[model samples]
Target: MAQDYSKKPIEELMAEAKGGNIEAQNALAMLHELGLIPEASAAEAARLYAKSAKAGDPLAALYLGVMHEKGAEGVPVDKSIADSYYHMAEKGGYHKAVDRLTEAGVGRRTILLVDDSASFRNVTRALLNKCGFDVVEAPDASHAIRFLQNGGRADLVISDVEMPNMDGLEMLAIIRGRLQKKDLPVVMLTSVREVGVLKKAKMLGVQGWVLKPYDNDMLVQIVRKALVA
Candidate 1:
């Protein structure tokens, strides 16, 4: 008989979590935080994360930092709390979370690209490189905020509107309201053509729009125009 580990029961997992199993706690935290379980509670997720973090789990600390930083999963937007967890994660040897604090800094009109697509990010990065602008990337708004909060600079931001977790408009609102980066130029790259959406972007002070299936030359031109404008 072969043993199957892929089908662990939730009851068993919950029991493990109750028994001080750090990994199980983290797993449960994520499940609730991301709403994988029906009617999942963000508060419960935060509590689980707290337990795991107290046990010195670096990943849990990192996640708590992210949740606090982004105000997601009902963690409440609190940089002080986020900073504490980030520090804990770093001290516990989580390099990626720490590395955000040490981004190479920016030079020569840096561009921040926000999107969830890996291939798109790669292609855009290459294009921007050839255009002679330094490029920084964030898979989502939270990461972008983390980059900026941690000392990364940007002359312009090109973002896709529709994204999981947090959309570009919400990100822009945070950028303008919370971060107070009012003067930053933002370009929207999306396939959406809804009037309501465009109106919202305009109200948010979007500097430009580049529709998807975009032409290489046109995008480069828009970038140039946005930089100079």
Candidate 2:
């Protein structure tokens, strides 16, 4: 059975995560990334991972890097970003990102990852970055627009279904309206298993759907296919 994380408070979550608890760490990171907790708490979660990563935690480093790249502490967003901490974790023989990077080679593919969750964004960002893709991130619709305005171009766009200020659908509409290029590949990551949502997304030209609690192999396959298509 899936662990019930909904009942755990942030402090307890942090404590458990810091105490070598992978599930707690992942859960806390997800909550921080998704804004289920106060935005300020995201920073706290990031701090927890700093310690965890030093102790050879790959997920911790991955999450921290995502938070930094996505500006979890209300910092300005910068897509071409790296986290030394994550690199340190990688150097400690954590092959999660290194393996992907090794297989992906140096030919860079640019990917834009837009989501409200700091944890999820970081984890995804790490995966893509390791896969030899240039990763850009936006917390919401407005941020995404700002990124594009500042000369961001992506081969693929991955976004969450529900978000504050602007949802993925709204962002997709804006992209279609403004970009002269009409065939950009867009994939939606959603926990909402509603058929109506999927149908609407298909109607609106969404290229793919990735369910949450994703399998890394499946994600890589979909991304590779999307980039090639």
Candidate 3:
């Protein structure tokens, strides 16, 4: 069940949020979004939603989707971007996010990240965003594919080898063979040194292989290179 935050003072909620309590963070963000507190601010709500979302809070991510969809409180009005946040929330177990989010105008290249590790996606997402790219994430290959099939956009895709539902090599094959996105750039981010898998990915036209112990700068650089190629 969600935390009961009804009786708690706003100051207590702020303190708990500051202490990294995800539920408290959402509660405080809701207050800001709803103007329930005298000092409520939509910008503050956006910040808290972003923080909690990155930490794997589904509802917070959903709120971010709403923010992006409506351009609320200085967030850009981008339906595609909103859907990206919605996908993130759905992957974290908050289903019912809008599935038919179409492509937004392609000013910034959007990268679809297919990895099961939320922490990894959250960190790399921040890094890529800092480098001027918009990043969307999925927990596995199926989710990544689902996003694409649902009118989601991606300029490049970075996927891990080991996934809970479908392995990355199989995903690459499907992307190349089934989806017929042969020209879509793909980079494998994995620690596996298995030559067979690497060869298969190469045959499938994978652009790059970045190991798990990756340099953030190098990964960003590789993604930039792939987008241009």
Across 1-229, the per-residue lDDT of candidate 3 in tens digits comes to 7666655677899899999998899778766764446777878888998999999977778777767775655567788877888899879876545532222212468899989989998988887777667888999999998888788989999999998879988888888887889889998888887767866776777877777888764465346435533
Which tens-of-lDDT digit does each residue in 1-229 have in candidate 2? 8665555667998788878776687667555544445663656666566667766776566555555554545433444433564476467654444333334632587888999999999999998877678888888878886777677888888999799989988888877777544688888877876767765676677766778987664466456545543
What overall lDDT goes with each candidate model? 0.75, 0.68, 0.76
lDDT of model 2 at position 181: 40
Error of 3 at 13 (Å): 63
Estimate, for each residue in 115-227, the C-alpha lDDT of model 1 and write its tens digit.
99999999988877875778899998889888877878899999999999989999999888888999998988888777678667767877677778776654664565455
**Every model: Cα RMSD to truth:** 16.3, 13.3, 18.5
Give me the runs in candidate 2 sitting further than 4 Å from their true place: 1-102
Q: Which ten residues in a row have the lowest lDDT in candidate 1?
A: 98-107
Off by over 4 Å in 3: 1-107
Candidates 1 and 3 compared: the better one by lDDT is 3
Model 3 residue 63 CA deviation (Å) reads: 40
Error of 2 at 136 (Å): 0.8
Colliding pairs, model 2: 33-117, 33-118, 33-119, 34-117, 66-122
What does candidate 3 score on TM? Answer: 0.53
